[model samples]
Target: MKLTLKIWRQNGPEEKGEMVDYQVSDISEDMSFLEMIDVLNEGIIDGSIDDKGNYGPVAFDHDCREGICGMCSMYINGEAHGPGRGVTTCQLHMREFNDGETIYIEPWRSKAFPIVKDLVTDRSSFDRIMQAGGYVSVNTSGNTQDGNAIPIPKENADWAFDAATCIGCGACVASCKNSSAMLFVSAKVTQLSLLPQGDVERNRRVKNMVKQMDEEGFGNCTNTGACEVECPKGISLKNIARMNQEYLKASFTTE
Candidate 1:
């Protein structure tokens, strides 16, 4: 099968980027999109064509191509990752594509996640948000309570675990039109709100994280489920709603 990759190319952050086309022939339909790009890079390295040295290697991001890490992010074929409801590009298989297809690839385009190079964007904004007290501040004194001692309801425990599954991949920012991290922010908020260990600093966590999220230039959540739908973890938008309740309560209560 043959595929035409229309990929975004930019020399630097300040430079303008445009879509550049390349034809990939003999591509197996079974090969993942990243795998196909790898093959293209190998061909370029092998000097398969004259003046190949003039052509730059295709750039993208991917560490655990197994979908566990949300680091492998890209706008594939106009979708967040690809033609999937809740999946990352790494987990996205090539089987969903067809022969002689023209695939468009772009990085996570967001103000908070500016493009560093090709498909790689800087997501330290997320790190900073987490740093703004997304954790509990307490002595890890070896004298701790037993795991089963806390009688948390099954439903709450399940929700807490689900929220903890967020991989911090920044796909929520990528898919959002406002480039908001509300879903990601909300997930973190809910994860702590539902857990016993996460209390003590619950009020502080929501305030700090929300403040940092706003400072990062993320937009407000307007009930659009794009963030949750594009999230590879299938993070529920319900978490955002829960966050809204928390934020409202936190806003009125004095520390």
Candidate 2:
């Protein structure tokens, strides 16, 4: 298969960036999107893909390509995580496109996610929000109590588990016109707030996480619901509502 990739390239965070086109041929339909890019990068480094040697290897992020790590983030053909639903960029296969298609690839375009190089963006803003409070205050080390001791409702447990599946990929921000991270932040907030294990710090967690999200320059949600549609894990927008409730309650209760 052959593809024309119009990929975004920037030397550094402060540098001007532009889309550069390159043709990749002999790609297997079974190859994961990253593997196809590996072929292109190999040619680029070896000076075989471009006779003029103008192209350097493109830099992108990927770890545990199984779609769990959420490190492989990309804006493909103007869509977050490509055309698939509930799939990360690494899980995207070459077969999703035609043999001779022209694909546009880009990094997550958000002020919070500054460009690093090529198609890679700095997503550490998510980490800072996580550090702000996405955690349980309780210890899980020596003599941890049995998980079943709390007797949480099945519905609540299931909801918490669903929200915990978020991988912090930042696709939600990329997909949102406002570049809001409410979905990601709320998923972390809801996963903990729904259960007894996370109750001790629930109020504080929501308050601090939301505060850090705003500090990072992430926009406010306008209720457009685009974040839910593009999230690789299908993290629900209901988490956002839950987070708002948590925040509202915290504002009155916490000092």
Candidate 3:
């Protein structure tokens, strides 16, 4: 198989980026996207790119290419993590593409997620959001309540678990026209606030998390489902609505 890659390249966070094209031959369809890039990088390492060293080996953020870590993020062929559904970029194999195809690879584009290099962006914004109070403040030593007797409403428990599946990959922001992080924030807020432990600090948690989300400079969500479609976890936009309700209610009820 042969394909052309138009990959975005940037020197640093402040540097302007552009797409550069390269063609490779005899690519195996079974090769993962990263593996194909590895092959391309090998060719690049074999030499320099003109006098500017432009065509050097490519760089992209990747940790655990197996898709469990959600670090392998890329916008391939105008889609988040390529055409695969409900899967991370690392799990995307080349089989999804056709021979003699031209693939456009770009990084997650958002002001909050500024580019660090060729294809890697600073995703620490998510960590900071979590730090701003995404978790339960209650610190349990040991021997809490009996799990079975908690009597957690089945609907609440299920919804919370679904929301917890979010892996914090920035695909939601990347694919959203407004680059909003509402879905991600909603997932965290919904997951925590739905439970009894999380209810104690519900008002506080929602306030801090929403504040952190806004501070990160992500845009607002107008109910576009693009984030849900691109999310590797298929996190629903319903959570965003839930978060909105929670935040508004907290604003009125909390001291």
- Measured against the true structure, the TM-scores of the candidates, in listed sequence, are 0.94, 0.96, 0.94
Q: Pick the candidate with the highest lDDT.
A: 2
Off by over 4 Å in 2: 51-55, 140-143
- Tens-place lDDT digits, model 3, residues 87-116: 888888899999999999999989899899
The TM-score-based order of candidates, best leading, equals 2, 1, 3
> In terms of lDDT, which candidate is stronger, 1 or 3?
3
Best by TM-score: 2
Worst lDDT 10-window in candidate 3: 46-55
Which of candidates 2 and 3 reaches a greater lDDT?
Answer: 2
Candidate 1: residue pairs that collide = none
Tens-place lDDT digits, model 2, residues 44-87: 88876872325378899999999999899889998999998899
Clashes of each: 0, 0, 0
Clashing pairs in model 3, backbone N/Cα/C closer than 3 A: none
- Score each candidate by Cα lDDT: 0.83, 0.91, 0.88
